[model samples]
Target: MRYTVVLSYAFTPAWLSLSRDERNAMEEQYIQPVFAKYADQVAARFFDAEAFHAQHTDFALLETEDLQAYYHLVEELRDTPLISRQYLTFTDIRIGVEGGYRTFEVLTRARE
Candidate 1:
């Protein structure tokens, strides 16, 4: 089954205070590689909630058939400075909203 993962996160003040060069290097040397590794199996998208008057700072969508890749990505990301330094605080993980009729079917059946 295909999976849709929505990861919502907020950035720490320290993260926002980083130099542009520092931020760029982190994205290039760390973050992007994580996505690149799973690029073929998953399509990743980023949304900046800060511009939209939202609670969270950022959002990411990951769609993949290979679930293990998702797990690995999370594990790897957890150790990055973005996470370890508490820069990117993960808020939630939402799964399977885009599961077509199966989504409705499952929710309907569970309502019994």
Candidate 2:
């Protein structure tokens, strides 16, 4: 089974204070390493939504087969400056399983 998680976050004033180069450097130094650690278990893609939305500035789409690894990935990120120093504030998280209904139906139904 595969799980998809959408994590929405907004940049705080602290983040805006940084130059573009600083932001990119921070992402590379802090964020990228966490993702790289879980590369085999989880896949992540980031999207910018500040232009389209009022609340969230960005959202990350993460697909994973291993929930434990995903959980660890988030834990590691939480310790980074992005979250610890209030550079980014997490607003919401939505998790779903791809084609999960079929899997549940098979597991819950009576067998002949």
Candidate 3:
């Protein structure tokens, strides 16, 4: 089964206070590596929503078949400066499976 997780998060003042170079460095040193480590197990796409939204500044749309790897990815991210040092604040997360109704339908047929 494949799962799609939408993680909505905001960029804190601390993050904006950093210079472009510093921000790039932070992503390179902390954020990018974690995603790279989970590259095979998860597919991630980040969206910039600051201009369009009021509550959250950005969101990551992640798709994965392996929940364990996804969980580990989150754990690693929590340890990074992005979250630990308050660079990014998570606002909400929505998890679901595409075509989820089909799974139930299949189960219903099997039981019939």
Candidate 4:
């Protein structure tokens, strides 16, 4: 079964105070590394909320074959400055509903 995790993150006061360069450095030094570590296990997509939504600053959608891999990735990310320095003020995780995308995948496989 495929698992999908959708995240809606709001910016914190700490993040708002940082300069552009500081944010870039944090992404390069901390955020990117966590994604790299889980690259083989999960595929991630990010959306800048302003373009499509008004409630959150950014959004992350993660897809993985193993649900545990997603949990591990989140755990590692929480340990980084991304979470520690309060870059995110609020977070909402939406667990996938198995019957939606999974149904399409299963039917496609059956056709083959």
Candidate 5:
């Protein structure tokens, strides 16, 4: 099975002021490790966030054999400063063939 994941970040107004490199550094330092930890179950094809917008969105395509393991990985990394809201969307291509994208939204608050 394989999964394509997209992550979006809903950023606060203050967050938008940061430079692209600043935002990228945050992910590279904090978020990337979380994903790398689960590299065996999920492989990231793309990881990027828009730094000039009030709402920053990070998108990624992941290939995974175990859905549960992927879910666990998402759950673990949902609250980091690099992201506000982590949305995991899964698409099942077949019983064994499943892939989806995830969107992580970086926001000011946890619920928003």
Candidate 6:
């Protein structure tokens, strides 16, 4: 089985004040390794932008064979400073298996 995981980040007011290189460096150093550790069970890709634009943001797509591993990866990421301070969103998860249909479920919290 294979799954596609998309992780996106929207900057907060404080995050917006940082330089692009600063933010990129932080993500590269902190986040990339975490994703890389599970590279065998998962394959990951990243997207980054120079500034905050509705159409532009940082994101990652992970292809994984283990759903449990994927969930664990998400949990691990949630604690990272890069994610803790940013508005995070994940989507485009699809399961691929022969002779079966693909499905996924996501639970999102409503902002206060």
Top-TM-score candidate index? 3
**lDDT of all predictions, in order shown?**
0.87, 0.96, 0.95, 0.84, 0.59, 0.66
Q: Per-residue lDDT for 49-93 in model 3, tens only?
A: 999999999999999999999999999999998899999989999
lDDT for 23 (candidate 4): 89
lDDT of 1 by residue, 12-57 (tens): 7898899989989998988999889889988899988888745688
Tens-digit lDDT track for model 6 on 11-90? Answer: 56677688888878877887788787777887777777537547446667777778888888878887887767663444
Clashing residue pair totals per candidate (backbone < 3 A):
0, 0, 0, 0, 26, 0
Q: Kindly indicate the candidate among 1 and 6 with the higher lDDT.
A: 1
Per-candidate TM-score against the hidden true structure? 0.83, 0.94, 0.95, 0.81, 0.55, 0.63
Candidate 6: residue 22 lDDT (0-100): 82
- Which pairs of residues collide in candidate 6? none
Model 6's C-alpha root-mean-square deviation from the true structure amounts to 10.1
Q: Residues 38-68, candidate 2: write the lDDT tens digits.
A: 9999999999999999999999999999999
Which model is ahead, 3 or 6, in terms of TM-score? 3
Regions of candidate 1 where Cα sits further than 4 Å from its true position: 100-112
Tell me model 4's lDDT, rounded to 2 decimals: 0.84
Off by over 4 Å in 3: none
RMSD to native, candidate 3: 0.9
Q: List the residue pairs that clash in candidate 4.
A: none
Q: How does model 2 score by TM-score?
A: 0.94
Q: Residues 1-112, candidate 4, lDDT per residue (tens digit)?
A: 6778888888777887999999899999998999998999999998888577667889898988887888898888889888887887546889785567778898999999
**Which has the higher TM-score value, candidate number 2 or candidate number 4?**
2
lDDT of 6: 0.66
Model 2: per-residue Cα lDDT at residue 3: 100
Query: Which has the better TM-score: candidate 1, or candidate 3?
Result: 3
Q: All predictions: root-mean-square deviation over Cα?
A: 4.1, 1.3, 0.9, 4.1, 13.8, 10.1
